[model samples]
Target: MNNLATPGMLTAVWISLIVYMGVILYFVVRGARLTTNMADYATGTFQFSPAAIGLSLAAGMTSAATFIINPGFIAYYGISAFLSMAVFLPIGAIISLIVFSKRFRKIGSAVNAKTIAQWVGIRYNSASFRLYMAFLSILHLTFIVLIAVGLTQVLSRALNVDALPALSGIVIFTFGYMMFGGANSLVYTNMIQALLKVVVAVVLLFSGYQLFTNADAGFFQQLQQIDPKLTAAFNTDSPLYRDFFEVVICQLIVGVAIVCQPHIITRSLLLKDDKGMNRFLWVAVILLILFFTVVFTGLYARVLFPDLMVAGKPLPLDAVMSAYVTTYFSPVVSLFLVVGLLASGVATLESLIQSISTTITTDIIAAFAPNVIGKQQLFVNRLVIAVMAAVTIAMSYQQLVNPDLSVGILAQNGVYASFSAAFVPLLFGMFLKNVPVQAAFSASVAAVVAHFGIYYGRLTPYMETGTRNPGIAAALAILISLLVGAVVLVLYRQTKKEVAV
Candidate 1:
């Protein structure tokens, strides 16, 4: 029953995969038709309803980690994981998006900024700054690897295929199509992915309701029986959730800063009108809250496999949910869940590829080679994507074969570091006008140093343990960058006042 080995089931999954790919290809082709230039490819030329764009935003933001991989952590840990990932993180990100979206969109539109690097570079009037930021954006390739690995784990298990082949297929197909679609196709595809995820999210969240039937030892009590720490708000046994500070405070700050990613912030630029933006935000927020709560399903996995073993072998943290789906659900439902998880990965993967490749081509390459025409720019964009795909395959295969406490760790390290550097520049650019570019530049440099320094130096007691959590380093970096930028801004203002006198 757990294996999902029937020929019928395998056939159904294959057919579903083919249909999904066909539909996606059709949209990509249509979107590519509308995309005549780099700007059109980056932000899309078509007019999209805010509701659709908002759903697209929600899909892009909630990647495989949200629906698939993070659940594995919750399955291994417990309520504390839920608190950090599901509750605090979402609250911070949503609040950040609400506060930052309008301002970011306004400035991005005024300057006609297509990528985050362009926004930062143009705002500071530094082409070198743009190149540096674009280089930093390459860090998002880690997220691309994370999604590839997640989808591979889910699909390979569901279809009983090898991880390498599944991973290769996923990377090639998704990235191959992504080279053509850009924002135009991405919006339509993401909207559909989001809709599918909404269905799967509802099913998974309600799946565990039966566990509550026992009065003397209900669901929470069952978790308490296995490991008393599982029911606790702070699981000291887990490195990531040592206490309230790491789980709540650290995660809150990380969540707030996480919205600074290029794929995430640039989502607002897709909306052509304010009415659409408002509707998009409302739909995205409500659905995202639902999608995030899917982490609670991890607790159900714990109940089924208390020891976290699928067979003779121990279940790796990343493999927990995929194993759970294979074992718990009927074959038909398993196939559906498999596609849902695939959607989760593709949604974010498309956005990352489009954003990062566009930044490299338009902001970095084109900035230096001003004579490069639009047709050549598009060619270079596709070429960059191909190079990125190759890099992703190499990194993803390494993590798949010999992971360091889950691919999520690798992802967090790169993602947190990039966004940590970006936060200061982005925040300063948005709210504070007339501030010295040196402050933004210096703040970015400090963030990179502080983040990597704290992480590698093992500066915090939380990171002294065998399992290192990148969230600590990222949270600290955000604070340090803010402080440095604030000091610089204040000093500059004082100098201006003195000169006036």
Candidate 2:
């Protein structure tokens, strides 16, 4: 599509973005000043209020997926995608957060674990397992690519620039600042981002108010006018929202396990103690619910562009919101909205970069490579973040140029696989005592195998279509992992009982 954004508007956006980056850099430099070593970088030494940590947690958990990518799915598939993403998935994740957070926090705090990999090593007493998880954490780079692509689509459209320059700017600015800020700067920036997201979410959700109030035809009727299935709870025409299996059940399972991600779960570790748990959770959950509803804006985008076309050309799904924003809003309001969108993308991007790099540096590099002292370790982490940026930029550029529908597919595959593997280890470690580490390890192995096997082998009905849903593979992996853990637990208990007798 020809540049829908005018030159004057593009210039305004560029100026505002430059100002935004400057403010962000100031914070990162300040945080870097306070950061003495790798430990401080991984987990902040700053005293954070429950509200700050909670908001940061929400921002980390809700990323480009909520604000950008998933909304595209909603626009394409209608209410079925909404139900799966904004409703059922939120419920499962919130429930998991509530149940898992307190227990996990107590253990994490007690051991003073810096990374999730370290938590696993400490919990199961296995250095090799920690190393394995550190390697698996590389999967999060797919998520980073999603954010990068999402941001690139938004900014390139807004600035009327090529995708490569926009992608480079996003990766370098976000990831470069991240190498300095770590958790200390991240929480501060994320709090601001979460607040911006709250405003953006409200604006986006209500942007369709005119359609809702139409006397001749309401929103549902309007959607029905376009496609009969669009108004339905399930849209069989869509690849990702075909049935209950794909829509409701699978999403719920994925939701519950999604909390096991390093950036998501490790947020609790930022808390000073257990006392902040309830307040932290309340703030995070309430804000997250609001953030999740932003996907409803996709429905509005469909109502605006029923044919998914702009300027007589078909709009890419990833660019739908960008088109919607530029088409609807005044240049000034569009600027703020663009900032919020950037916040949504970069907040989680910052967290993922920080967490993944820290994991690699502390858990993998330190464990294997020659003894690295405090200052050296800090330097190593910065180096790791730089390397991660290079890799992410390379992958992100490919997805930007050529994607399989949306980048969500690639992200969900890698991210879901990592968390699926982590679920058993996290569950058994937090809740159960004296459990054989082998059971958790076996379950982890089985979960990864099951997820990849089903996905690649097309073992299930969900994979029969041209575009496969990763949720199906993830759900099955989680279930199989649970079963494997249960079997091992029972056998271990039986042997102990026999020995006692």
Candidate 3:
């Protein structure tokens, strides 16, 4: 029983293609006729409405990881992992909304800012700030691209096709849509994609609930039934469960790093006023509830289907999410799931491309050739965009070629890429005003070390043991980062007084 294919399912694939591609095309067309001003390219002129901004914010923050592997969290970690983000994420968004959002809007409106680099230059009066921000900009692009590639591959599987062609087509679609529409387009596209994904994921989650209640296959019972020998928590029997601290350490550390994410921060920059940021509180509540639903759906699917148990033990990253879509639902519905994946991937990549273009033109190029103008900069920017995309595509495909690679393994790289670059600087910028430019520079070095420590030190052990809670390890890393930062502040003060006298 190939089980993935049915007449109804085949119709689903085509229908979803039409619907998903149409929405994405609409997304791409939003900024097609704009002038070549850097302001126009980077921030969409801040003309997007609040609803559009909120919706896009919702969509842009999610990626293939949310759709594909988020469920893996529930399958492995139980429910509390969901609760931490449930509480933390909305609070994070609210803080952004009430505190950071207004400041960002006022600053952007006041200065006609284009990118965070431009803001840094204005705030710090330093070319070095822009240079540092630019490199950080490239780092955002890498993870964004990584997530997009994963989404496209998963979407292809939903269509019952090889992933190579899907990657090519999706990238072309992403490139064309984003290259044309720029930020303005992304605003609207994220809105559409977000709503679409939320609605679809929620519906499926509820259906999964019904499957658990009305049907006889709820997750725990199904698990008990699926394999009796599988009994026991990480400590009791499973090897991965033996080191629960590692899981807690990894996830919590990842959460702490989440504070610095540029993709998330960019949303703060797009707000119309401080009020919108406050409004973000309600938005955060809504999104987390939806996110929890999606996670549980994956967990439920794990229980419902035992055949996905790869090698009689291992489960694929898309194990529950993809299998549930293709195995149980009609093909048309599965196609919509594919569409969701594609939309998520494109929205993510579009933002990445925009960030990369801005960083290349503003940070890297203008430095060496301050006088460089117009058509040439466009050429250079496009060149950078292509080169960066090519690298991301290569990195993602290398993993895909080796299907033996688990989503969990690839996801760890995301944890490293995300936290190390974005977290420390953003935190320092907010909390530590007295730290000198050199100290800020040095903190990134410290963060890089911390990133490796968490990755090599604790996360590896947790992963090997299949431990669910990585919280303890995360707290340690953040604490270390804070202590190191304080030491930097004190040392800088001593040096400053010596120079002044």
Candidate 4:
């Protein structure tokens, strides 16, 4: 909570951030040269290597949550958070990515779909559904706000500035370049960010090496010395990691459906051909596993800040990582860590801006006013990004000032609702043949209702709690969607059979 960054560190961060902006601008200019139309902007005109695309996927999937936010949860609740976030969540997400990527890409390519909404509409032959999903895609703005807030937390601490100016600068700069870069520049930038994150992840993970060496006991024992609850398999004291259901079952379900988001699932479409699929998957999975483990740094932070305080001030859940980096590391090392932290947030933030803006421009706006977007689709897309920037600035400011535990909760509520709605449609469309559009549509609607209905309405005991878990609501929503979809599919088949008879 205190400004731990020295003047020297602030100078270093400013220089590094400026140089970083220049590098990003160079890529944006290059990518913009190739992007004459919205289509080129959406999917890129280049044939990227599987390794590059894989790194992009890894970077996009990790986001600020992996490097910056979720670790706060780990610091608070302990290993139970680690198992839920790093272990079980990745297992389910990787499996889902492997299963869905190829099939989704196949259909997406066949239909020439650029965005998730476009893919859904073309897959089911429904213009209205595309518009509906495009509107739903606006939920991703919550995620963008999450990344913005995370980046602001890091930059504000590193530069010794207030959060408002830091957030505004981040949104303007990132969204400005993203309007031009799209997929073309996003992959290259993400690949670089992923590599930087790998270095920082290693540095952060091993920063606590002294803790392991100084104590006679093992790591878990050290944690036990701090608090037995920190070493426990389940942290009953924590709201989110209270039990087996919340820690494991709910996370696994959410992980599987999490890939249904546009920036994540559409990464497969960036591949030029099917032959690259294996290499892409291999690179992404390996990097993701490494990136996920970065949450272990939270354990180290917990060791350092036993009471989660600095200078007699309590650390917010979101500020734990920032406090650790500034307080524990040397100025030069903290400089590197700060830049890497920025990269981790920027990587996925870029993807979200590109994918969401494209969806709004090509899917939603074009649906309503096709003639308005006739030849100046690129201009319209830029305008949409500008509007998104304003919205992000407004929403992120609110979260920075007053959050529900952390911005992660607000993000999960909106993002979980989105992908929960998307999961049924994508799953039924991918694996099931002759599935009625009505079934998928009905299931998507049910998912939206179920997720928000549970969260805000507090329909269940889990929701009734003060600190509600979005994963519980999301998992229930997914299950309800599956049930509703299956029932509808069966009824449709029965009606068809009766008609044939």
Model 4 vs truth, CA RMSD: 1.1
Q: List all candidate RMSDs to the true structure.
A: 1.2, 1.2, 4.0, 1.1
lDDT of each: 0.90, 0.89, 0.59, 0.92
Q: What's the lDDT for residue 241 in model 4?
A: 89
Instruction: Give the C-alpha miss distance for residue 138 in model 1, angstroms.
Output: 0.6
- Candidate 2 clash pair list: none
Supply the TM-score for candidate 1.
Answer: 0.98
Residue-wise lDDT of candidate 1 within 284-304, one digit each (tens)? Answer: 899889988998999999998
| Comparing 3 and 4 on TM-score, the stronger one | 4
Two-way TM-score contest, 1 vs 3, winner: 1
For candidate 4, report its TM-score. Answer: 0.98
lDDT of 4 by residue, 1-501 (tens): 655467766777889999988988998898988988898899999889999999999999999988999899999999999999999999899999999999999999888898899999988899999999999999999999999999999999888889999999999999998988888899999999999999999999999998888757777777888889998889988889888999899999999999999999999999999999999999999999999999989999998898888889888999889889988998888888999999999999999999999999999889888886534999999999999999999999999999999999999999999999999999999999988899999999999999999998988877787878899999999999999999999999999999999
Ranked by lDDT, top first = 4, 1, 2, 3
* Least accurate 10 contiguous residues by lDDT in model 2: 1-10
lDDT score, candidate 3, position 117: 64
Tens digits of per-residue lDDT for model 2, 315-415: 88888888888787777888889889999999999989989998989988998775996889888988898898899889988988789988999999999
